[model samples]
Target: EDKVVQSPLSLVVHEGDTVTLNCSYEVTNFRSLLWYKQEKKAPTFLFMLTSSGIEKKSGRLSSILDKKELSSILNITATQTGDSAIYLCAVAAQGGSEKLVFGKGTKLTVNP
Candidate 1:
């Protein structure tokens, strides 16, 4: 079975602080790894990593994949209270039906 694990299940930070979240996975014929941020309801897509060592960035958020290690990392800079949310990591495997297997997620709380 494919599995994803996220480190530091939860974190507390003040406004303007930077945070790093880690995710590792094990799956057969891995296709990609995706990151999502969840707030009130559904999760919002963050990044999708397929090739190793290429970092994907959007504003203060960025992510990179390490295929050799079967892992990925998400970095958030200058985090604000508005950035408080659950960060989810999912992996897509190459198979008949494309499905994403998600991790429990890392809960981040950015205080004012």
Candidate 2:
């Protein structure tokens, strides 16, 4: 079985504050680690980390993968009200029907 878990299921941060989202997993034949930001309809891709040490970054959001530890972290800097969303983490499996198995996600609220 492949599974993913996220910590601090929810968070409240003030505008301009920084936050870190945590995700840990136990997976079989893990292929990659993916991060998504969800506000309404569906999750939007944030980062996909496959190799260790290298980080994926976009503006105020960044993430890194740790294959050896079977974990990953996402950081949001200078958060704004518009940054409020659910952060999801998933692991990609090799040769699996469900390409990715996801965590319940961490809900973030940035107060302006």
TM-score of each: 0.98, 0.96
RMSD of 1: 0.6
Could you say which candidate leads in lDDT?
A: 1
For residue 91, model 2's alpha carbon misses the true position, in angstroms, by: 0.7
lDDT of each: 0.97, 0.91
Worst 10 residues of 1 by lDDT: 95-104
Model 2 lDDT per residue over 61-107, tens place: 99988888889999999999999999999899887476889999999
Model 1 residue runs over 4 Å out of place are none
TM-score of 1: 0.98
Pairs that collide, model 1? none
Model 2 TM-score relative to the real fold:
0.96
Candidate 1, residues 1-112, lDDT tens digits: the string is 9999998899999999999999999999999999999999999999999999999999999999999999999999999999999999999999887899999999999999
**Best prediction by TM-score:** 1
